[model samples]
Target: MNSVVELRHLTKVYKSMIALNDVSLSIEQDSIYGLLGRNGAGKTTLMSILTAQNFATSGEVEVFGENPYENARVLKRMCFVRESQKYPEDSKAKHAFANARRFFPHWDQVFAEELIEEFRLPLNTTVKKLSRGQQSAIGVIIGLASRAEITFFDEPYLGFDAVARQTFYDRLIADYAEHPRTVVLSSHLIDEVADLIENVIVIDRGSIIIDDSAEEVRKRAVNIVGDADAIARLVAGREVIHRESLGRVASVTMLGRLSSVDHEYIADANLDLAPVSLQQLIVRTTQEGPVDPSAAATEVRSVQT
Candidate 1:
């Protein structure tokens, strides 16, 4: 896949504090990507720069093979739907949609109306009067309905309940499969959208820490539950992302996939292996601090062989 967005040594600074420091990465075209990191990890800053909503202090940024800053053609092809999205206090949902219809060349009124009904949104009500979830729904509706070539959703389900959030995920994938586009989603609810995104790019302390396929990333760690002594022996000198004990059964989440021989060792030692979710892996990875991208790749390969 070709890179629709590219950043080379991207850096963003404010006063003395650095929001993004020497960050560089590429977002593939027509692919769903998960842009994940802890709070204040510069996820928003990265997206804002990509969509031309903010300026970069240094380095280069390109979207759709062109600089996005003040480029009408590029900006119109991209839609940024974020939790902190703004609307006029007196404006109604339809007003926002009307503006969207005018701005997006491929806006689908039919699709937007269907989404409105599904989310039970009140069109006539003032955007400020609507519940937080309702306001979020409006953004979701526009994001999907616009069908722009590139879309960035920064925690789009901020005020959404469980069911409403699921609706967003379901609709996003359904629409994406039908109308393929480059979609970058930044969310703390990692596991929920784990299956939807094909690639995972994680930012830590304003740096690109991990960038790889979701499947490949998942295999980086494995959880083992059984005898603490047996677990201790297996994980000796290895990195343990997490660990807990319940009486005699000790659960340890260790970095690196269990090789076939390692799995056989665990079986013989009466240890049980549990599958680790993408969210758990990411959380552990972040907690572990500034993971070396090359080391992660090497570990993935070492365990697989």
Candidate 2:
């Protein structure tokens, strides 16, 4: 498959704070890539650099096989829809669509109009006067209808309700099936988009920590559930990602794919194995260490002293 975007040793810094550190990644063409991580994990910075909205402090970035900075050819083919997108204070949904139509060569005015109605956005109302959900709807419409070859949605569904969010996902998948362009979606709502994404790229504290197919990542770990003692025994020597125990029942997740022999061993041990969800796996990998009880006690003692 062709690469739509490439980053080599990409680094971005702001004064004393490092936003991205030696990050290198290649986004495949015509795939829905999930750029996932916690807040302040360099996802937004990376997206901005890719779309030419922000400059990298060091290293290289290539979009459409060319540097995207000030390059109209590359800019015209990419759309970056972010929660912080700004419009004129007096602009309305119609006004935004008009601007998008002029910028994107493949803009579909008809589809944009349809989406405006579907999202129930008031055409005459000023964008700033609209509710947060309404404002998000406007962005979603443009991002989907623009039909840009590479589209980036940076938490674009912030104020939408569950039903509206579902509609956005359904429409995105349906349209992508027909159009087949590259999409990079950065969202904290990991479980919601798990099925839509074909690949996952996880960033942690300014570095790329996980990059693999959604399926492969899912298979990298397995969850076992059974009697507490048996489950503990099964995970005793493995790299445990997460563990939970309730009464006499326990569940444990560990890294590494299960081989045929391992599967047989599990069956012989009578422990039921289940596939781990993408959200669970991500949380395990990216979560900070458990709270320190001793530190909490020390703070309390200091207050008492």
Candidate 3:
């Protein structure tokens, strides 16, 4: 597949803090990409740079094989739906649709209208007067109906309930099947989108920690459960990601798949194997080091404050 977006040694600094650090990534064309991390992990910063909404502090970024900043040709084919999308105070849903139609070459007014009805957004209500979920619905409608070659959805379902969120996903998948394009979806809800994403790119502490096919990453680890003593023996000397014990049973997740030798050992130990959830792997991979004893009391106090 061709690369639709590329970043090399990308860095973003905010005065005294680093937002992105030497991060490099290549996004394949016509693929559904997931940019996942915690709130402060720089996902928004990277998307802003890719869409030319923000200038990178250093390094290079290319969209559609060209620099995106001020390049109308490249910009015209992209749509960015962010969490904080804003509109004029007096503008209504109808006005937003009208503006979107004027801007996007491939805008589908019919689909937009359908989405408005599906989301139950009041067309005559002022944009500012709409509920948060309605605001998010506006963004989702534009992102889906615009038919941009590359669309970026940065936490665009913030206030959507489960039913509405599922509706968005269903529509997105159906639309994507009919019109294949590069899509980057950034969200903290990992498991919710695990099936929709073709590839996973994890950013932790401003750097790429996990970049691989979702299938490959899923296969890189496995969970084992059985008697506590047998589980410990089976997972001994391995890279344990997570472990939990209840009564005499213990479940453990360890990095790397089971080799033939390891499988034989597990068989001998009589432990049952289970699949690990993507969310669990992400949490374990990104967790910080052990807590400091001196700061433990201080941390508790800070939480209460």
Q: Tell me, by TM-score, which candidate is best.
A: 1
Cα RMSD of all models vs. native, in order, equals 2.3, 8.5, 8.2
Model 1 spans with C-alpha error above 4 angstroms: 246-248, 299-305
The TM-scores, one per candidate, come to 0.94, 0.91, 0.91
lDDT of 3: 0.85
Candidate 2 residue-wise lDDT, 1-305, digit = tens = 99989999999999999999998899999999999988998999999999999999999999989999999999999999999579987888889888899999999888888788888899899989999999999889999999999999999889999988998999999999998999999998999999999999888888887888887777777788888876666656556768888998888877776656566666776888898888887787778432221221121111010
The segments of candidate 2 whose C-alpha lies over 4 angstroms from its true place after superposition are: 246-248, 288-305
Q: Cα deviation of 269 in candidate 1 (Å)?
A: 1.2
lDDT of 1 by residue, 173-226 (tens): 999999999999999999888999999999988998889889898887789999
Tell me the whole-model lDDT of each prediction, alpha carbons only. Answer: 0.89, 0.85, 0.85
Which residue pairs in candidate 1 collide?
Answer: none
Clashes of 2: 0
- Which parts of model 3 have CA positions greater than 4 angstroms off? 246-248, 288-305
Candidate 3 displacement at residue 96 in angstroms? 1.5
What's the true lDDT of residue 154 in model 2? 99
